[model samples]
Target: MTERKVIWNGRVQSDMVDYNGHMNDASYSLVFSESLDALMETTGLDASGRERHAYTIFTLEAHIRYLQEAHEQQALRTTVTILDQDAKRMHLWFEMENEDGDTIATSEQMVMGMSTTTGRPGPFPEEVEQSLSPLPKLDREHWPTHANVQMGIRRK
Candidate 1:
């Protein structure tokens, strides 16, 4: 898998700590969203790109698993991997780690390009597609099929 440069790098703020004395859940989602903003730009959907193309990405689905707990003021670094992608949608996985290289969280998302005016799913601009073509994509067939990865799960 190809990884992007540090998409987000920051420290958990004291105010973000929860009653249990750890960084709260919402903060992790916030960091992931912030990192996605940068990824969008790199993949050619920045503010200017939207204004010119009349389309932007919209989240179709998201899944996050809390791997470990982090405390306030702990440095965090989030990296992005393009798990799978198509003309209209991009699937991504992110790993958030602390300064000590311990994984704090992981998130996977599916996002689709949407036309602002038509309010419907849309294809990306040619330039955008060309820019994203070089990014790595995981082979879905080789990915683990266990649990809720690609198939729905129901406890028996």
Candidate 2:
């Protein structure tokens, strides 16, 4: 398995907290999403590039595990791992952690390439594929091996 790849880092805003006084579940999704946005840039799948090819990625499924809570103003970071990929889709794992290196949450996602103009599923362009080739191979072991991860959103 490959080591964690830090994609984005930031602070937890007080506004992101819920009534329970910690970062809300939706915020975790946002963090994971923003991190994925960063990775997309690195992988040659960003907005301009996708638009140029008339294709983009759509999330097919997502699974998250809340291990620990994050509070307001806490410095945190997200690490992403490309678990698997093919011409049409990519599977990824992400971890949200506090500055002290504790995992606050984990998310796994399956995203598919789709034609922007026609909105039909399609494979990535060769240029995009070539750009993503240099990234490390996906390894499931990099994520928690035994946890029961499933597709379903959870409310904090």
Candidate 3:
């Protein structure tokens, strides 16, 4: 099983707080999006790499769960795990933690590679694929407790 890697680190800004006096839901999505961008850069899909290879990654789906409230100015760190991947797509899990190490939120996303020329899902370029090859993959048995959870009201 691969270890979770810290991808993004920042504090909750005043603008990110909602009327509820805590970080807004939209801000959580924003943070996760930034984390995805970091992942892209790590895998050599950054701006220059994308331009050279005419390839980019797109979010196909995302699920976010807010576990705790975050106040403005609170430091936050996002860690990511590569749950699964193929030539054209990846399933990622990200966890947002407070300074004290409490999980504030989690995001699970499925992203796909697209050829800029075709504007459709396509396999990653050879260089990007090679870059991604080094990232540790999480075995199914080692997935986090929050991974792959079904969302619905629990009725007993």
Candidate 4:
């Protein structure tokens, strides 16, 4: 894997705590959403940049697992990895961890580039592709797998 960037850092706030005395489930999603914005900034796909390029990336899917508990006032940091990508789509993962490298949660996300002009999903702009093309791509053996982490309902 390549060197991932620390996209987001924050301290768990008292307001984020719930009756269980820990950060609530919704807070995890909020933090992860902020982290995703940071990722977009790093790749020049943030709101302003998208406007300049007339293109945007949309989250097509996400899978989040609350692996461990994080209490109020606990310091946190997040690192994002580009698990896979092509011209138009990206598969990503974010790890939310404490100071000691203990992960509190993990989020897997897939996003696609769309053209503002056409109002349809399409290939990313050259600048966007250039910025993302260098990230390391992980193979299956090294990819993390969770037993109950599949995205949709399973039925016969």
Candidate 5:
């Protein structure tokens, strides 16, 4: 398995804290969303690339699990793993860790390439696909246990 690369880094701001005195539920999603942008930039989907190819990536779905609390001023880092991808869509897993290296949250997302002109799903441009080739790709068997979870009320 290739080592996952840190894609984004940030510190929890005072505004991100809730009455509980830690990052709020929505804040976790916000950080993960920012991490996605960083991933897009690395894959040649940045503003100029999107304009040049008339293409962009859109988040189709996202599931985030909060494992620990993040406090204000705590340093945070995020890494992404490409679980799978096709011509038009990608299954990605993002992990956010606190300064102590404890995973505070994880987000599994499905994103797709879209044609900005037509506002429809489309295959990624060749250059963008090529750029994504170097990123970490992990097989299903190697995925973390928390990944691919189905959310619902459980009863036995």
Candidate 6:
């Protein structure tokens, strides 16, 4: 895989800030999730499409590190890489950068494919996999290491 960029832009809202005046931890997850959604859209697989295919993605693991604060009104950008993929899993890396290109946060996500109705793990469909197989590989050195704590936002 080659290096490629998937852009996700964010407009910091007042509600996203905490007492410290920066984006709250939960807000960060929201931005990251939205970015992932946009990235998947590029492959013609949005939330609804996943259901239509009877294949959905669930985040199995994630490592995220915050390097800088994003205040209200700041414009944030995100770049994503495919990292790795097999029969039923995928590893992806997402980098959040400020308007100046400064790294604000990074997240490495491990996702698994599952049958929507059956709720059983399964491999990605050939067409879906083919559409997403062109993403770039992750650079080990670039994987975020500062975040050692485990965190996640489960879909309800």
**What lDDT does the true structure give each of the candidates?**
0.80, 0.83, 0.92, 0.82, 0.92, 0.79
The TM-scores of all predictions, comma-separated, are: 0.85, 0.86, 0.95, 0.86, 0.96, 0.83
Per-residue accuracy of model 5 over 1-156 as CA lDDT, tens digit each:
345879999999999999999999999999999999999898888899899999998999999999999999999999999999999999999999999888889999999999999999999999999998988998899988877889999999
RMSD of each candidate?
A: 2.7, 3.9, 1.3, 3.0, 1.2, 6.0
Model 4 Cα displacement at 128 (Å)?
1.8
lDDT, candidate 4, residue 48? Answer: 86
Query: Residue by residue across 29-95, what tens digits does model 6's lDDT show?
Result: 9888888778767765786778678877788888778889999999998888866778988788888
Per-residue error at 90 for model 3, in Å?
A: 0.3
| lDDT tens per residue, model 4, 94-137 | 88998788888988899898888888898887877777766555
Better-scoring candidate (lDDT), 3 or 6: 3
- Clashes per model (N, Cα, C within 3 A): 0, 0, 0, 0, 0, 0
Candidate 3 lDDT over 88-141, as tens digits, reads: 999999999999988889999999999999899999898888887766678899
Stretches off by above 4 angstroms in model 1 are: 1-5, 141-156
Worst 10 residues of 3 by lDDT: 128-137
Clashing pairs in 5: none
Lowest-scoring 10 consecutive residues by lDDT in candidate 6? 141-150
Better of 2 and 3 by TM-score: 3
What tens digits encode model 1's per-residue C-alpha lDDT throughout 27-139?
88888888888778987789999888998888888788788999988899998767777779888887789999777788888889899999999888898888777655557
TM-score of 1: 0.85
